[model samples]
Target: MSLFSQAFRPVGSTRADPVLVALWVALILVAVIWIAPFVFIVFTSLKTNTAVMGETAFALPTDPAFSNYAKAWARGNFSVTAFNGVLITFVKVPLGVFLSAMAAYALARVPMRGRRVLFLLCVFGTMIPFQVMLAPIFKQVNAFGLINSYPGIVLPYLAFGVPYQVFILYGFFSAVPKELSEAARIDGASHFTIFRRIFLPVSLPALSALFVLDFVATWNEFAMALVILQDPQKWTLPLGLMAFQSQFQRDYGQLNAAIVMTVLPAAIVYLMFQRYFVAGLTTGAVKE
Candidate 1:
């Protein structure tokens, strides 16, 4: 049943579902709690250093000196960080999603000779933690002298994100009705065309969700970026933001301001894709 009743279906005519309302309230409350830190960060970011540390950490700033944002941009080099982040996200998301979708489509739909083995391989690939494998991967990159470079960062992002991406896409594609795919085949569409026209467009919502997820994950990724990227010039925002902490007993105001700056792009992206994000998650939740 639809969460909301249709106009034809009289208002308050469906099940009185008090439990659902209660659940909704609970979820909203939880979301508020989760988002509180962000709110605090934003509030502090708009305050001056004196205000942030003064008797106003939790209270509103007297002047609300929003220039802290510009200070953060200038001091933390968040522009460069955001630029690098965008570069990595653009390169990784499409490539990751496409590769994963293709892999998933084949595993789920095709009757290949070794299809079961391939599925098992994909599952096994996701089982190993990236940290365990990081040393060897870094060694290989070092051998290629890709350390501290864009490719060094990007290659690992793709490699790590691929397994989960494939897993999700595989399930989604498998849930597609075979009859529709067969009709496309009978209509003389090639496999590529069928997938491109039929499946890809239908899965737009899920793709949007994946894009937001992959972008955020790649953007905020700190561990690998820290280990692989050694040059201060190439440091991503997560690492760059850390510099504010270690210098002179920590400037919480600038740190918070830098954090707010770092968060803006991802927040803007999420807002833009929110419609798709909700649809994607809900649709992806639907069982076969």
Candidate 2:
């Protein structure tokens, strides 16, 4: 039998299984729909501006121009901007996760007055949209002379990052058996020691997941970065991509190249941590 027939046909049968064939066809269609734009961007990045705008936007580049990436990188000042993004992501994500984890541990493990109220307040903070806080945050940043600086941007990232991380970690910490902590406590382990040695190690999957998430969110964030980072030197990759696109508005190839560059780092970061992310997500799905 031909490969096509074999693929669509059920074993021990001369004809295709209608249900399997339909499902396979639907999957292929969805896959194409999902991947079409990325494929277009790759093709477009190789074509000239005229070709991109011309009748053959979907056509393969007849005269592939590979220099667009080099040109976009140079024009976009991506080296510095990408580095700035990495720096900000590296600094903020760890701090945010650590702080959030600590808060979560206390909320989950410690008995305190008004704990429910405090925990609900943290959850409530997440509901307040970032857009609503923009004006007030900008004002506060300016008042504290944090505007036009890295700390200014980093601090807000941490603040916004903490609540969600805490919420997630809180659940994980809660799910941990209290018997372990009790055993360690009977051995004279301090709260800090127990947390540092026990809770953190066991929560690696969740922490890894949160780290990946916060890193991407901080990296792609544009509105606050644009507002606070006035200097061109401190612009992150997303801001740099926007500025590059505007400056080379007519150069679709360059624009697409810049976009590809902007996307690559985040994609790589996600891929690197994807295993842990998926594991962490499934950690709490079933009872032990």
Candidate 3:
């Protein structure tokens, strides 16, 4: 059953609450509102430019133009940009998650000195906005001779991705039973072994959630990528898509098609990992 059905379904003699039903209706309405733009964009993308301009903005195309995607890809240089996005996201997400998990595990489970300070530093990082550091980061990347390179864009992602990830994983780690770690230690397991064998298996949901979240965030991030990557060949999808617009005229069809292409990967990633995303969010939210 759907979430709304499951939420409202009466278990026995009692009818569903009127308020609950009202809330459900409101939720559905809100969802429709939220998704309307995407639906319009998809339909508009399939239409010819002349049809889009001449016809009612939301009307269905008389003849669909599937070639819009190919035209967008060619004009936007998305073949290169998409590959860059994939490479950066793939490289950054796993490394950031692993390192963040290690840091979280240490803060949550280990009796190491200054753990509190380190954890506090991580927390502080999460509070700071990325835009505040953008100029400095760009200069640092340039200083390190990483400008317009994969590593230039990727390094900042790793740095910025970690604190938030650590914040998420720390809650999950802290929820783990201390006895499990103690038992592993008694079995002559090192900290690495305990983390590898004990915490990791139990944290799959959170990991998968972070994987999806990080993939989407990294894939969509525009400002940082724009600054660090100066070359058109190194541009990510968002920058590539912006190429569809010039000062005088915008190719709405091509622009919309590029938007759809950019949205597809993140949608696919979320769908693949969605089973874990909800559970992960709720599981570590309350300490038992």
Candidate 4:
């Protein structure tokens, strides 16, 4: 059942269920709690630094300073950093998802030795914290003279991102009926053809969902970009935001404006893929 239907579904014939009412209340409370910071940020972004510092955080701006966004855009060098962020996110996320999807397909459909062990190892990799691998990743990237380059950052992102992508896609892929593969094979469809034409097409929801998630993660990635991209010119949005914060520490208005700018793209991407997200996540949850 759809969430809306479930949420409003009446018990018996007369009145609302107390349990459902309580759940609705709890959900509203959680939504408010989650959105409160964003609301504060928006309000602060429109206020003067004086107003931001003097007034309560939740206070509405007495005099809305729309120029704060202009100042932030210019001072934050958002044009350049936004370009870099877009480049990295667009380049890294789709490529990572595609590669991970192929890996997942192999593990799911292909006959291979120790596939279970390999899948287990991939799952194990997700457990290893990125911090633990940072030094070694930096060392390797530096050894290859990739510091401050896009590849340096993208490679690490793929490495860290793949395990989880595979974990998700593997379950989705495995759940596909084997008869489909058999039928495809009987029609002389190659494994690559089957994967590209059949599997990928049917997995649109999962792929779209992964793309949105990975796009957001890649766009907001900080530590890896910080370590790999030393040059200011190559800094992504998160790193640029950090620099913006440091340079404009006392300018709360501009700082919050910069934050809103940084968050906007990810939010846009999420909304674009919102329809597929819940379905993708619950793809294999129940078997008929």
| TM-scores, each model vs. reference | 0.88, 0.88, 0.94, 0.94
Over 1-288, each residue of candidate 3 has an lDDT whose tens digit, in order, gives: 255556786787245566777888999899999999998999989988788889886788889999998988887778999999999899999999999999899999989899989888999999989999999998899899999999998889988889999988898888888999999899899999999999999999899889989999999999998889989889888888766555213678878888899999999989988889888877766756
Highest lDDT among the candidates is held by which one? 4
Write down the lDDT of every candidate, Cα atoms only.
Answer: 0.80, 0.88, 0.87, 0.91
Against the true structure, candidate 2 reaches a TM-score of 0.88
Q: What is the C-alpha RMSD of each candidate to the true structure, in Å?
A: 4.0, 3.3, 2.5, 2.8
Off by over 4 Å in 1: 1-21, 284-288
For residues 133-174, could you state the per-residue lDDT of candidate 2 as single tens digits?
998999999999998789999998888888888888888999
Query: What total of clashing residue pairs does each candidate reach?
Result: 0, 0, 0, 0
Model 4: per-residue Cα lDDT over 1-288, one tens digit each:
256445676866455566777778899899999999999999999999789878998988999999999999998898989999999889999999999999999999999899999999999989999988889999999999899998988899999999999999998998898898889999999999999988998899999999998998889888888888998999988999999999998998999999999999999988988999877877777878
Worst 10 contiguous positions by lDDT, candidate 2:
1-10
What TM-score number comes out for model 1? 0.88
lDDT of 1 by residue, 251-288 (tens): 56677878877778788889999999999999956566
Model 1, position 5: C-alpha lDDT score: 27
Highest TM-score against the true fold, candidate = 4
Report how far residue 168 has shifted in candidate 4, in Å. Answer: 1.0
The global Cα lDDT (0 to 1) of model 2 is 0.88
